[model samples]
Target: MQLADLRRYGASHTIIQSLRDIGIKDIYPPQLEALRLGLLSTKDSFVIASPTASGKTLIAEMAILKTIFEEVGKVIYLVPLRALAGEKYADFSRKYKPLGIKVGVATGDYDSRDPYLAAYNVIISTNEKMDSLLRHSSPWIHDITLVVADEIHLITDAHRGPTLEVVLARLRQTNPNIRVVALSATIRNVHDIARWLNARVLESTWRPVPLKEGIYFDKSILFDDGSHKEVEVATIYDPINIALSVLDEGGQALIFVNTRKSTESVAAQAAKEVGKRISDGERKVLEQASEEVLKALAEPTRICRRLGELVKYGVAFHHAGIHSRQRKIVEDFFRENRIKLLVATTTLAMGLNLPSRRVIIRDWWRYQPGYGMGPIPVMEIKQMGGRAGRPGYDDHGEAVLIAKSRRDQAFLFEKYVGGEPEQVISKLGTESALRSHILACVATFLAKSEGEILDFISYTFFAIHKDPTDILSIVREVLRFLIEEGMIKEEGGNLKATPFGTRVAQLYIDPLSAVIIRDALFKAEERDRDLTPFSFFHAISATPDMMVLRLRKRDYEKLTPHIVARKDEFLLPLPGEEDQEFLAQVKTALVFLEWIEETPEDKIVGGYHIGPGDMRALVELGEWLLYSSYEIGRVFKLRRAVKYLSPVRKRLAYGVKEELLELVALQGIGRVRGRNLFNAGYRTIRDLKKADIEALTKVPTIGKEMAKDIKRQVT
Candidate 1:
């Protein structure tokens, strides 16, 4: 299966040369099988279940390029995460743009139809973003001839699976002839998914780099192949000792921990030993990388400082807590082999190209809210372990699980070493999951009546894996709720979304969240009560879509008084004292209040017991919800609430006080730069407009280039 062989299936000469330029000379077995199954030549769909790095992406690439060369319609590459979307976008753009292929990425603003994406030959998008585009009925969607669903196994994910399921069903429903290339990391139920999609299945356990499974106990490893090895490392810390042994063998280690704190603590602990192995040249590079991490934030938080220091020693920890830019730096450094040891949470296992020679599962058990401590799913453990080998670098990869005792070692060997991954099941059985989707069906004309809605759902993976009767009840309940809440209407055996329902669907919010917002605003108007900023923030925070801050035990006492003082100011009525959700809403709303009040990022993260990235996520979510609330208010004709929400949405996005909003609106300006200009007597855009470049350069943090750019924007 050479790159040249793809030409038999319509791969262009430029595509072959591009593959060779990137050193992709031969296709792996699974990819070869896909191609043989008419992946490129035919219009059939495929469900490819193979291990990570097994060339699943290349198969999709061949099909995508074939479509483009044949003058087929547009292509949509769907990913489960924004980071993966960005990765695919960059890779495709860099490789194919010179060949006259236009690549675009859409992972922002769920409410947008992204009409601009119509101009691209290929559009990479996260599943949720694609679903939003479908709800808005983006005209370009009709032009799509193929959809490459990366990480298609996420259809079993409880939180995000429903969206992917609905998106796939809807795409197929709208485009009856659309080709699908669904990729997954070797799930047990590949056949079930294949049956649902009516696609051919290609399953394989082959890896470009061979993987070895083992269990570690008492400085010794028992390989699943019935072999034993003794380690000479002199450290009681199991992760550190394991990492050191791998470093001695001239390979890097990726240690997976159960918690964010463990990632940092373990990386810091391993940094001491890892530092001794670094050469002076490597040390200089690591130092530069560390500085880049620090500069990712305007005012580095404590976590950022810790990560920066560890990166200097060729060690780094990664999790959702780190800012996106810093995470990119760490990923790039590790991929370049500048970082010797990388510690990360389960997020690293999802779908990223960062691979290492050794994968250490430091924590196999995680805390489940109601279930106490439970073992991680074998599927997820395998996904994490599959990242062990870097193809073309390491000949073999070791996935080691640490055990403290003989019993634990035996358990690990039997459970994970020889275990089969669980079957993929549909997670579209809950009301919260079906509400927005049902509304979207009606709003987008995918379904017009209850029977048609069920018909649309029959295409979902849920219909195949579970009893349709179960989802039938949930769907009916959701429909009733939508109608009673005035989001939809039933007239003469037909179903349709009202203007409010259409707006809610297009806004990409749960219909219940819209109901809550609309009712709160209406109540406030009827009572003729004026509300504060906290009231608006709290209203959005209580919605199901908002990921509210965790309520610590101490926060209950601390937030009670503030809640009491502002109780009357809230648009929604206060919850009872025993409601933890009430406390969370108040606490989360305060974070937003501080954000818009011009508080430093570090201070806000510290006070809220969250990471800087977490704070940023809250702000981003808050901004979207506020904007949605404003749009919903307009649909309901809540004029007063609409006026207050428009300015507040802008303030939340920039994380600045109301007075500094004008300054932050400029291209190069942010919360900090906006404040610098405001405090320097440039209070508004008008003030900056009247100033010259030289005068603007006098302000703190404003360099000559930036000053000139600012002046250019104003002029």
Candidate 2:
């Protein structure tokens, strides 16, 4: 359908002109189907299920613009990942800001209601963030008329899916007239989701660029259509050989592996071959990009150095281990076509728009804890393959799996190349998943009794597939746990959250984590001696919300002595000496201690066998959990624990010792700069107030502008 046809469905001339300005002359098949199903004229919800790069986002854009131009109530766009949230926020803000539409994003600090979002015409947020907003009873939520759930298929994810499901159910239940437009790339149960939402289903297999699936074995690719092509590159490494062949054909490649180590090693090998193919002009551009990646941290870690070197050859590996700044540099360079190849783990498949001309699945089996190596789900494989073809760039995309033998080749083709994506089941049925949601329901006054809680559950996708009796049993168990934990109380026949319960919900932490922190605080207060910083760090690390580091073989020997010496200082109970969980918490706590002690980033990452990115993530979570513990303490009125936690929280946030906390409070000063000024006879903000900019500039790593900023702040 022509873009102008949208005007017939109440679309304004301004909206149609905006589409024209962006060069969108024609709508794709799935978009046309959605519009024909009363997308613009009716209040009914919709599920747009289509292949990647098939204009799924445009359909939502049409709906959003129509609502904005018509002055419909506020709009909420939910994304599955924080990276996707930022991408959408930037795109929407840039596109719609000219139309006088206010766009806002909320992805951090789950405790706040972010009342400023009320001024925004459209808001972008992650699933967890939105859920936290709802739990805090943000008043603007009642004004929302539309919500777009991007990647709705992720409701099947075990860790994050429950929150997404709960957010959708709460939004629908609160605003019966609100319209939802759910988008999914690969889902076999799209119709079931549609029925659950009482919405129309628009399912299509059309792609903007054609896709070809195949299997590679013995340097030959056998396409699913019975055609075969030979890869002439001579290399001992199969992935490098395949990637180089794609580069020879004037196209970029994405290599998908199962682990972070594999991504780096594979990219390192490919970098050698890729470097030989780059022209001098391209090399200069890549060298600049490489330097930017390397300098992302003040002190580069080992992974940073290796990644910087690889990017000089137009190759980079992506995983959660790399810091966000460096990851953004790599993504932007690849999108600009400066980076020829990207090697990544499955994280890259989570709705980033970085597409390549060819996608090579180098590993189909992933390690599952306690389950050994297992085949990846067909849905994830397809999502990775979907990154092959850029909509306007590649005429056709190739998604090929590597096979070791004839038998492996046949299995790869049968299972993945020609397979249908799996059906998505709701992951909201378990006790661990339902505990927080159930508490939130009562905390927010969404439900008052057992029947009301069950009614709320009936709105979830879980209820559609689960037996009512099974759900009832689980709900009862969650309620009992909450009651026993003193988070909820039964008054007469109604249910209400106690002050502790309300605070826990508002903190957006696991109810279990709050309980853990509460118990630790009370126990520490009962003791006589002062608690050390390691005690608070280890206490938070033991919570379910914190992602503790994995214990290595050498960690036991190195950690045993310190743990044993500090046993009395720990807030939580000590496990046996050889216990893996105890050792992991000890290791994680030590990392936090080193961070606050102003240890350099490289040494911490090197000693802990982690990437700089991992350290950054752990620090961020540690800060939040520490602050959550403080908030819990305030609720319970634990005077001593709260007094100690406030300063420790600051130390964790600035990555500085307590003595340097006042100096690090300045705008440009960090751990390095703070320490530099202290050792130079400037210990506090008073010392900075007394010094001139010239004297401050003499300190290491402090430039003239930094010095001026520091002087301006202190004065």
Per-candidate TM-score against the hidden true structure:
0.97, 0.98
lDDT of 2: 0.89
True-structure lDDT of candidate 1: 0.87
Q: What is residue 577's positional error in candidate 2, in angstroms?
A: 1.8
Candidate lDDT (C-alpha), each? 0.87, 0.89
Model 1: colliding residue pairs: none
Candidate 2 regions off by >4 Å? none
TM-score of structure candidate 1: 0.97
Could you give candidate 1's per-residue lDDT for residues 111-223 as a string of tens digits?
88789999999999999999999988889999999999988888988888999999999899888888899999888889999999889999999999999999999888888
Off by over 4 Å in 1: 6-23, 369-372, 526-530
**Candidate 2 global TM-score:** 0.98
Error of 2 at 411 (Å): 0.8
